[model samples]
Structures are given as C-alpha cells and as structure tokens.
Target: MASKTLSNSLVRHLMKRGYAQAAPARSETIQTSVLPNKTFIAGVDTNSPVARVTVAFRAGSRYEPQTELGVSHVLRSAAGLTTGCASSFIIARKLAQIGASVSASGDREFVYYTLEATQDNLQDAVEILASLISRQEFRPWELSDNVPRLKYELAALYPQVRAVDLLHKAAYRRGLGNSLFISPKRIGKISSESLQHFAGANLTAARCAVVVVGDNQDKAALVANCLQLTGLGEESKAEGSKYYGGELRKEMGGDLAHVAIALQGAPASSPASLALAVAAKALGNGPVTKWGADNSVLAKAIGNIGPFAAAGFNVSYSDSGLFGAVLSVPKDEANCAVKAVAGVLKKGGLSADAIRAGKNQLKLQILSEAEAGTSLAESVAAQGLTTGNVLPPATLAAAVEQINESTVNQALASAAQSKISMGAAGNLAFVPYVDEV
Candidate 1:
C-alpha cells in the first residue's frame, strides 16, 4: 500500500494549497527560442484549421541609410520576384496547387512576410516561404517593371494617409521620420543593387524571427531551423529618435482637413508605454458601439462640432513612441475643431471611469486581434523582434489588468507637460499653424 499512501498524501497537499477547485494561475501556450543560427522563433497552438508563419525583420523604412531613402517600401513590393532556386511562374504554381498564399508588408520599424495554409499543408507553405525569404534575386528588369504599379499605389493613397506621413516627418525628422511608402520622387530611382545592398545589411537571418501560430512548437521550430536566409549581417541598431515639436502642413484643397497632434511617448515594452496606451484610449479612441455617441472627455468637450471625426492615436516603437489624437473635420469647422482638440490634449486629464473604460477597451481590442491569426502573427513577430520574446493573449490581458490608476495618470501627466507637434493636410486655409492652434 506504499503507492496508495503516496497518492493520498499528494491529494492532501493539493487540497491544502486549494489547487483542485480553481484553474492554474497560468497555462503558457506560447513558446519562443533562438536557433543555433541566431534566428528567433515563436510558436503557439491555437488549435485552428488555418496556420500562419511569419518572417519579420528589422528592415523598416527607418533602417534605410540616407542614400537608400525609400528602399524598404520598394522591397515590400518586390515579394514573389524570381529567386535563385525558383522562377515567378513555378512559385505561383506551387502555391496555387497547395492552396496557400504569401504576402509582404513593411512599416517604420519592420518588414514582415507571412505565409498561410492549413496545418496539414504547412510544410509545403514553409518551402514556398523559404524560397521567398532566403533566395530573393531582385533582377533589374523586374525592378523596372514594378515602377508603374508603384506609381498606381502612390496615386491611390488617401489624403489623411499623407497627413500621418507628414506627422512622422515633423516629429523625428530623419530616422523615424521616414515614410512607410516610397515617395514618388524616389520611385524607379531605387535600383536592384540598392535593394540587394539594403537587404544584405538589414534583412539578415539573425536579424529576423519566424513566428508560427496554430501549430506544434516542435514542428514549427524544425521548420524555422531549415530556413537558410542568404542575407547575412547584424542589423544596425536604431539610432535614438529625438522628438522635435514642429508643424507640417499640405494643402490638398479638399472639403475636410486632417490634423494630428502628438507628444513624445514611451518606448515599446515599457510600463509607461502601456500606461500611455490606456491614456490614449481614455482620451477617446472611437465610438463604443456602431453609431454610438462617444462619451469620451474630448468628445464631450468638442460637443457638436459639425461633421467631424476625432480619435486618440498611440503607436510605440522599439526605442521611442508617439501618443496623441487625430481629427478630421469639414473645412467650415476646422478652426473650432482644431482648437478644441488642442485644448483637450493640453488638458490630458484622466478620470476613474475613463481609465476603467480604456483598460477594458484595450484588453478587448488586443484579445480580438489575437483571434484574427494574421494580425496576431504580425504582433507576435514584432514583439519577438524588439523584446526577443512573446506572450500570449491571456497573459497580455493580465498585464492590462495590472495597470493601476496611478500609473495611467502618471504617464498622461508626463506626456501632457511635454511640447506638442501638429500635422495638417487637405484645405489648409482654415487649419491653423501649430503656434496659432
């Protein structure tokens, strides 16, 4: 009866600790590790039919040297070009046969390539992904042919998008100030050699991370281990982004004016960043429900400014961040709306109710985004790039829960006291300069 006695004693110990009735404190499903070749890999089991794998690099537009200003944007469009091991036709055919797809996207701080397929077909998807990431051959002819498409993309950009770009320009002025899209002037000027050189310097295998969701961790690690990226170099560390508060305005002569005002925010992965995020939401994001009236402090302050839209915006990068509000209003209402937004930002007050609402809303947004696998994969990969680790939605939500009211108010107070920068586009006659506002 020795084994029976031992089992009885274990049961008694568990009961004493109150572990049987309640769930364990955590069930860590996300796993991250670095391969021998120095590539970071993160995997999570979603138990879903669709599986996704992402290869993310510190090859964003900001990483471009002064000589290669818009190369990252060009590189984003150069996905699926002929690689060393496969032609365009063969890659497309294989992907179509396997019912999989691959796409590329870039931002200020990262370039992401993602492949999606079912779990059973993930191996095939990995092969296709490898060809794209490890064997890119940016041929001269192919690069030239991409110009028209790039021009079309530039033409299709919305004016508000331009306003956001200008905001970045005025904020940091060089590194983080770079645009996410290629400028029209830079199109066709970026050559194959430039693209290859940029990749060789910034998009190295060691500088990237492969993040897989809805798959076995072991299998995903094996898949990541097989990736042999040709580009090899340590990515240049991001230069410290210093904030310069100033104004950038472009007159598009449209009926609506788009304006963004911001203060220097906290770095990514900092408690201050999370606090600032909660403050952004507290300041007001958007309507709570469809067509619902926003009860946000800013909304209540701007009461009935005709035909206008406004929301707080917060984006955090590895070293620095930006937090503020963006307002779009009719030309007739621009003056009044702009002042009201500026006034609200200047106040930067947070209430108990607002903090509770903001924390709850941010938690819901992150959790919802995680359920949509593509966004979650991108997010995890970005975390993997900067922090060298990833946490699941459950743990992230817990983090939100841990942000007390004091912390949120402290971050807001700090940002509010800092000088603000303003960016405006479309029908600028009514929009005031930063000093005027």
Candidate 2:
C-alpha cells in the first residue's frame, strides 16, 4: 500500500511538472507607496499595445453601515456620471468609440474602477478616470436613472448568487457579508441623497489609489494631474477599519446541495499562507491533485460514485483570513461528502508532491494574471491592501521554495485546529453534527 501510494504520487508529480514547464514566464515592475496608496505597475508584453488603468479605493462594502448596505455599489456605478470634462454617459460612449472598456466593482474590502484602452489613448483614459474619481457630480437625474437599474440587477442576481453570498455571510459576520454585496433590502432602501453622502464621505482623495500599466513615459505628469484633481493633501486621512471579527457558520437548505467551509488561515504576510493555499489545492483540486476522484476516500465513503460538477476550496486573507471548501453533491450523498471532507481534515493526508504541484500551479496562475494589464493592476492593489506593499515575485518564490512535506503537514495541522464554518447553497440540506474534526 505504501509503495502504491508513493508511485501514484510520483506519477501525479511528473504530470503536474510537465504542465508547469509549458507555462510562459512573465516580467513586470510593481511600484508601491503607503502615504498616498499608489501603485504603478507595468506588464511588458511586446505584442500588445493595450494599457489598463485602475483607480482603486479602500471604500468598498466593508465601509457601509447596515442602513447603507448597497450604497457603495451604487456609488461605484455613478462615479463617472458627470465629471468636469464629460458626463458619465458621454465618457462611456467616447471610450466605446475608441475601443476602450470601463467598468467598476465593489467588494468587501475595496472598490475598483478600471479603464482599458490602447497605448495611443492612455492619457485620455487617465484623465477620464481622474475626473470620475475626483469630480463626479452625482447629478440627481443620473442617480435617479441608475438607482433603479442597480436595484433591478441586484434583485436579479440574488436568487442565483445567494449561495456564494450566504457562504460569505456565514463565514464573515453579518455586516461584512452585507458589505460584500448581499444587500437586497438595503438596495431597495437607498436614496440618491444617502448615496451622495456616502460617496462624498468615502471616495475622498486620501482613500483612493491609482495604478497605471502601460508604456506611458509621461507618468509623472499623469500623477501630478491626478493629485491636482483629487486635491489630496498630507492632512487627509483614509477612513475605514481593516479587521473583521466573526465566527463561521453552516446553513443548509433546498434541493441542490452546497457545502461551504471556512477556517481562520494565515495573515497575507505569513509564509505559511502559501502552504495553506497548497494544502487547499491538494484536498480540493480535481484536474491537478486527483482529490476529487470518485474512488478517492472522500468520494467512496460518501457513496458519491459519479463526478462532481464543482468541488474546490478558496483562501481569503485580509488582516484575518478564512480558508474553506465548498462542494456540490447529490442530496443522497451530502452527509457522506461532508463526513469524507471532515475525515481528510482529521487525517491530514496532504502529500509533498501535491503541495509542490499546487504551489507551481498557483505561481503560474499569478503569472497569467500579470500578462493581463487589468489583472496585474488588481493583483498589486489587493496585495497592497493586504500587506501594505506589493508582494514581489522574489517573496513568493522564497515562500514556495521553503514549502516541503513537513511544512505542508504543519499547515494542515494548523487548518485542522482552525475554526471551520460550513454552508450549503443548493438542492440539499447540510448540517454540522459534531465539532471535533
């Protein structure tokens, strides 16, 4: 049995290494700052002339109060409405005419407004973003026009997206989850007056970050223009709390089965975070680790003889972080799947080869993101928010190099002791019967 396991592990390792060898290497420079929360990153792709610009802010859903749940999202939508140079509609239309794309999103931790345009249109794009960030008029008619549309979209997304949102809600506390875009009732309650107040209070120059990725040799002038437009002074302070204090819970219901689990993981700065990520990949990744196989202990014991449409785990980090798995299984096999997952957690059977493969895969995935201008900007922005600096490739390389069998085992042990919060989203009901996994 030992020899067989070792042979299987070796085969998997070689297969994964083959995939890694084929991934292209990416090069980029990431510049970071704290006082102004600015990031200037450039992805050097010789073939593409397209550049991506992003103006990100700390003012995401987490800043929203219970009464103002969906207001941040609404603010993101209205950011470009009527700036000094152009109205939001005209700006969007002009960008489209120039083959540029502009969009925005509000997450639990931040709000990101992005613009992608060709190198020729870089300056115009930056001006457009700067105006949207600093000079948005929030016209009454624009708000009136957009509020209902946003509400309608939110209403439409609720039933379909409820499972993931509920998982976040159960994992993070009520306020944080609501901040992360689960605000059906709050969406209905927001008024244009309240949205204006929220935007004015939160979307200040001090809270914003500008990340430009392209061959814009005139970066200094762009930065100066952004500073002048924002009127950001040294005295201005960004407002918001970074810590989320909460417990994880599992909620089960309906015909479709959803299993969401969360445990307190390492801070973004910890070297062990990479290991924790590798462990998650080992236990949950199907194409990479064979952890989702039907004959595997988890599947066999669950009596789940067929393939799972989706089965994976996610690791989320802020000041504090959570790592957990969510699986979709048939109603009849739900209990078994849960027990099997719990069994793996208890046994801590994560292999060395699996850890190495996961690290390689994750590294490659990060590289792919770097190949895209917008993704690269978001990557740096997220890392800056979490660690107060860009997590450089050298840092990630060192962390991955240090991960081995012993370290992976240690990470698994840490996760085993972690607070596990589980949730179900689909056709079947899931319940946590016992605590000691």
Candidate 3:
C-alpha cells in the first residue's frame, strides 16, 4: 500500500511539471551570403554555448606544382608560426587569454584553420584567424623548424592512411595523385619562397570562406567580423585531375599484409555518390562490437582467414573519385582475403532490409558529424569552396531513403567493371595484384 502511494505521488509530480508530451522540432535553418569580392559566408544557428569558426582555402596539395611537390604541406604546418602583425608568442598568448582552442587540418584538395570558444568571444576569435591567414610570415628559420614536425606527423601514418595515399598515387598518377604528406625525400628541397608564393597566389578572397555556427543573435556580428577576408591575394590556378588506374606495391616488412583495391567512383557532384556510400556501408565498416561482433556479408566472406577486417571507403574529389575496400590480414592469408572480397563485389545481391539498415547508418553518421561544431564548419566551408552552397543533413537523409537494393547492386556492378587500382604494403609475396583480383 505504501509503495503504490509513492508511485501515485511521482506520477502527479511529473504531470504538474508538463512532462506528458514530446517537444516540437527545431527550425533547422541554414543561412548563406556572398561578399562583393566573392568570399562566401555561411552560418548555422544552434543552442551551443561554444561558437565554432573555420577559415578555409581551396589550396590543397592538388594545386602544388611539379617543381615544389610538398609546398602545400609546408604551408599548412606554418599556420600558427609567425605572422606579419604579431609574433608567434603574442598570437598564442592572446588566444590562450580568451580560452580559445585552435587547430589546422588539410587534405589533397583543401586546407583550413578552425577555432572554438565561448559565444561571447566569437569576434575576437575571428580577428585572430584573419591575422593568422592574411599576415602569415613565412620565415626561412620557421620553415626549417616545421619540417621536422611534419616528418614526425608522416611517420605516424597508420596502414590505412598509407594505403589511401598509395591508392591515390595509383589511381590519378598526378595532380590529385600528389601525396598529402611531406615526402621524406623532398623535405629540404621545399624553400620558404615557394611557400610564400603559393599562399600569395591561392589564398584570395575569391577562393576562401568563413563558416560559423553559434547563437542566432550573434550572426550579424560574425558576418561583419569575417569581412576582413575581403580585398586580398590573387586567384588560384588549380589544374583538373584525371583518373588513370594501375597498381603500386611496396615490400616493407610487417607482420600483417595491408592491401587496398579501388575502382572508379562517382564524383562529389554526382547524385549516385549517395548510393555508392550506402553500398560501401553495407559492405563493411569493421565489426560493430568486439565480443559478439557483426556477421555482415563481407565479414562472412573473409571469415575463414585467421585475423582480418574489411572497411569500405569512397573518396570523392572535385572531378574524380575512388571507391574500394582496405583489408588487413595475416600475410599468409592475404591472397585468399583479396579473392573473397572481389568475388562478393563481382556477384552482387542485396536485400531490401539490408539497404534500409545501411541508409539509416549513413544518415546517422552524417548527422552525428554535423552536430559536432568543428566538423560542421569544415563541411560548410568545403561545400562553399566547391559549389558555393551548403546542404543540410535532412536533404542527404532523404536522398539515402530513395536508394534501394537495386540501386546498390547497380552501383556495385559499375564499380566492378571499371579499371582497378591496387596498393599493398608489408610482406608482399602473397598479396594479389589488380589483374589477379
């Protein structure tokens, strides 16, 4: 009797607090603007205490010339090094005073500097970003200091990262094929002058953008602060990238065999790109949990091997893309693992239920990334750089829903017939080549 009375009391308390129904959805609006000089500005208002900002450039490794192979990597490392307006120590001290966090990251096609701090300090953060990118001083001593750091970063590239680099090398041969990291062989060859010239030519208002996500009331101030990006630099001369497939192998000795097999894929602008991503998720993304583990199609196909895992990946560039799987296995079973994966792709059949699950997984992945402040800023910046528009997660979710089993099957078939690029590292005696697979 006493227990029943306590339950009744709790129910009455919840009812008085108005906890009886679900809350309504958010507005989910995304706003955009283009400055007179062509710099793009976009904002996504959210209920986050911390504000996020990104100053991005279209000048990635792909734009580097034949003579200066890794100048882009060097330039990226020089992000916080000294600027004409302030010494490195002053920059660091002022940012720390505001309790701001800063970072730099790049890929083959883009580079960016990101800042995250309390909403109240958003304007200060933007000013610091402007100073860093616009007045960056490319001193020779600083360049020498950063080369060792870059080398250390490259030394830590895992098998997956190395495989992707080799895969791009095999697929494009040049331009996009250029490695994203500094090649140890070409370290001393990259002079400070080349770094300055590259930045002067590519970091123009026309090729750069400022992206922010924070309180709705602060949107006007954010845009005003970013206006500092205008009236600077010259246009970039980015060459078109072409896909030419082949094979590349290295005989580095390691316990496990690392192999990556890729074929031509849909570019970022293609509608089929969403379908391809779903198809990849269905293939495999590693076992979901360690204990019971997942028995997805690709997982079962390679189950006979002693120790192995498969991950489906699709890399989309502005003009070309690569879709394939990277497998790590015991060296002796490498051949068997390769054949099994290829056979599954060649003989494609997926169920409707599987397609539904894969689509949901893809949607969740995209949404989760967007909810994270820094990642959403990067996505907006990349979209603005490429197409001058940003796509909301809901639009991508709807696209994933339209994909069915037949769509995935057709995508798989198209991929299987395209020219193949194979890359392998470690004990390579047993690893299969592209033609053999």
Each candidate: how many clashes?
0, 12, 0
lDDT per model, in order? 0.75, 0.55, 0.71
Candidate ranking (TM-score, best to worst): 1, 3, 2
Which TM-score value belongs to model 3?
A: 0.89
Candidate 3 scores a C-alpha RMSD against the true structure in Å of: 10.2
lDDT of 3 at 182: 78
Determine which window of 10 residues in candidate 3 has minimal summed lDDT. Answer: 16-25
- In model 1, what are the clashing residue pairs, if there are any? none
- Rank ordering of all candidates by lDDT, starting from the highest: 1, 3, 2
* Alpha-carbon TM-score of each model against the true structure: 0.91, 0.79, 0.89
Model 3 backbone overlap count: 0
Q: lDDT score of model 3?
A: 0.71
Across 44-110, the per-residue lDDT of candidate 2 in tens digits comes to 2334577766666667676776656677777776766887678766987887777887788756666
lDDT of candidate 1? Answer: 0.75
Which regions of candidate 1 fall more than 4 Å away from where they truly are? Answer: 1-28, 230-232
Candidate 2 wrong stretches, greater than 4 Å: 1-25, 33-48, 155-161, 216-224, 227-254, 288-303, 346-349, 430-437
